[model samples]
Target: MMLQDIDAVIFDLDGSLVDSMWIWEQIDIEYLGRFGIALPDNLQYEIEGKSFSETAHFFKERFQISDPLQKIKDDWNEMAWNKYSYEVPLKNGADSFLAYCKANDIKLGIATSNSRELVMNVAAVHGLEHYFDCIMTGCDVEKGKPAPDIYLAVADALKVDPSRCLVFEDIIPGILAGKAAGMKVCAVEDAYSEAIRAEKKELADYYIKDYTDFSSLY
Candidate 1:
């Protein structure tokens, strides 16, 4: 009955479904290092929930870098592609959880702030592309997490009512986004968001430390 009450499930890709958040941190270090700019201590937390385009703009403005916004995104994508394609692994129990959703006939969607090319690459490499009925990137929407645009778009793509959707997210902004879209959100635990775990729990409708924990939902 619980499963029946939810028509669709949406997941965030990075920290929520895969263990690739560290890659971005390292990339930031290296990218800024190229300009002899040391990354700010609070930069990661500040930009944790921003869309790909927004993050690129932030880097250009904050660092006073000469690169165009698109160029910054392209360079970061280039640096990240190989790692996402080969090194990133699924979060604990993600495989089984996705299988469960598919077997249960739950409409599955992915709404991510990552680049479309990289998202497809990672999904294909992990064999997750088949599980998603709809996979939308930040570029597909006008705004990103905390703005509700991406999640709303995914819900539309899946042809599901936002009120009947269940979202799994790792960051506070993402949790806020799902809630703003009128969906119930489960905050997934990720080491990248450790500092804000308590905050996430407060913001989400439910809190799950791992995908296996969803066993109770059945």
Candidate 2:
């Protein structure tokens, strides 16, 4: 909806604010290949909303990897660094929408399942570090999306009531997390989640193909 109705706007980083979802699947394939394990077709769906740490744990247990969890995370971060630094781009019109939010004095924050290092790298790449009031990762909370912990933690960090916050997300679990936190949720369209568009529309209060769509709302 309109900016006037919300005091804060929280965003999910990966598919929501940037076109980087493709990188993860590539990483998963490459990483698992290193262990001589074939990538499961359902792997992405299985780990949809899990935190970085949780995903590492899943990989460790599910694949029976011998490496410690931290090593797994570190290796992933290393593999993803160059790609995120070079290839990932912000979603269409995201910069302008961030600018609009800044101009309107609306607080902004990121509640992402991604690691803090990666999310920060994304901000640096797009010169978006200054746009956020808070940048929280799922590791900061006990649970990830669909449980509402990360979004709630972010709202608390921003000192805003959950009801006064609006969330932009691109996946079903993220939309569910925002709604569970009592915030209005806007489902963002991303090719990675295109197959589940109808479920997203049904679950979210609003849906947009890109940040540019916000222009029509006002």
Candidate 3:
């Protein structure tokens, strides 16, 4: 299917444009270790598209952290940010895809569930800031992914119609949010297992195994 009508493309940061989900896995292990809980071998599918507050609630409730959830998230952010500062790399074919969007005059923006500080820093550290017309984070909205708020806000800020923009997402909640906002939604495979893949396949309009598959998308 041709994404010929797409005038803009919005990207989800962690798993879609950059392979940073694995970083979260490492952090989860360490965080749980500090609390003497055995970390699950997998955390991505549960955590994707959730905000700090929401994630904190999940960890707290699931593992009984006992502290205020916000504090837990803050501590995690402090720990994660240190590594996020230097380790961001564009996923395979992402830079080329960005270039393709630019060359064709398609508007670009980042609509991520990540914090603004982390998102901005990663974009700059990897020289991706210049390609985007706007950058928006989940903090900017009252509702994060699974709610249309962030994607809706990014489309608004870009001054584009929602129908004219497409979204690249790695999780079902994000895909649902984008589609609910009346945009075409595409999924980028980011190391999900078969079970995860079957679960996420239903939410996205299209699925791509790699960025190379997105080359002719527009």
Best by lDDT: 2
Score residue 93 of candidate 3 by CA lDDT.
88
* Worst 10-residue lDDT window, candidate 3: 192-201
lDDT of 2 by residue, 1-218 (tens): 34657999999999999999999989999999998989999999999899999999999999999999999999999999998899999999899899989998999999999999999999998899999999999999999888899999999999999999999999999999999999999999999999999999999998989988876633
Query: Model 1 — which ten-residue stretch has the worst lDDT?
Result: 209-218
User: Which portions of model 2 miss their true places by more than 4 Å?
Assistant: 216-218
lDDT of 3 at 19: 79
Question: Looking at model 3, how many pairs of residues clash?
Answer: 0
What is candidate 3's lDDT per residue for 106-190, written digit by digit as tens?
A: 8999998877777887887888888999998887788878999989999999999999999998888888899999999888887
List lDDT for all candidates, in order.
Answer: 0.89, 0.93, 0.83
Candidate 1 Cα misplacement greater than 4 A, ranges? 1-4, 215-218
How many residue pairs clash per model? 0, 0, 0
User: What's the TM-score of every candidate structure?
Assistant: 0.95, 0.97, 0.86
Better of 1 and 3 by TM-score: 1
Q: Write the per-residue lDDT of candidate 1 for residues 46-138, one digit (tens) a residue.
A: 886788998898888888999999899999999999999889999888888889889988899999999888989988898887899999988
